[model samples]
Target: MHRFKILFVCMGNICRSPLAEGIFKHMTDNAARAGEFEIDSAGTGGWHQGNPPDPRSVAVAAAHGVDISTQRARRIAVGDFDRFDLILALDRDILRNLRKIVPAGETDKLQLFSRYARGIDEDIPDPYYGGREDFDRVYTMLLTGCTSLLDTAGKLRTS
Candidate 1:
């Protein structure tokens, strides 16, 4: 089997995107062989560049027994277009922004994160300025989406 690289994207790397990255990584790690898939995330902008995932975001993920304390904020770069097999955006705006940067040949690799969600209409909401509940809600939403994503990616990997 071949290893596939996935990049999660959002307004900032500190919130939704990192949560998705952490959740997806955990699911994939427990499902497939040691190196079947890789997950990472970055922001559309560099506002939080060099920062760690938000305190609430880390706390929420840790509460669920997932550690996302090591994630650092980064802005999406041109090289990321080539590095990741999938460039997943948290919302329509980020998807649109990604579309502008991805070349024609690679556009198919870019997508809305909800495409992997099983039965949800809402994308993961950013929890930068909200309360702890917001982070908790995003944690749940991404848990569903990332698990679904891992299922699909794992299937593609096995078959």
Candidate 2:
């Protein structure tokens, strides 16, 4: 079977991107259990390169029954542009950043996560502010996006 590589991106790897990574992993793993593809994530900035995701983000992901504790934050490498089949950005700035570096020949791999999501017509709101509630809510928002993201990946894989 063919496995598709996916990379989720955000400004800082510590929160939203990792959360999207985890949620997407959970959704894809479940799909794999029933037959599906592969997934991963990264950040556009290297600031949090070796750091773990914010504890609050971890707690929220755990609440959803997904384990993201072991996933360390990493900046998107130049090579990742060639590696990932899909590159989903969390918001506009990162999307713009990705566009700048996505190589003139490889820009087709980039797409906003929300564009793949039917009802979510905007950016995946960053939840770096507020508290646990913010993280939890962002998790829910990303959950829908992840499911929608995977459903799209599934179709391309089978077709």
TM-score of 2: 0.91
Which regions of candidate 2 deviate over 4 angstroms?
33-35
Measured on C-alpha atoms, candidate 1 has an lDDT of 0.84
Colliding pairs, model 1 = none
State TM-scores per candidate: 0.92, 0.91
Screening candidate 2 with a backbone cut-off below 3 angstroms (N, C-alpha, C), the clashing residue pairs are: none
Badly placed stretches (over 4 Å) of model 1 are 32-34, 119-121
lDDT of 2 by residue, 4-78 (tens): 778889887889988988887787677653345566778888888888998999999998798999989899988
State the displacement of the C-alpha of residue 83, model 1, in Å, after optimal TM-score superposition: 1.2
Quote model 1's TM-score: 0.92
Cα lDDT for residue 78, candidate 1: 92
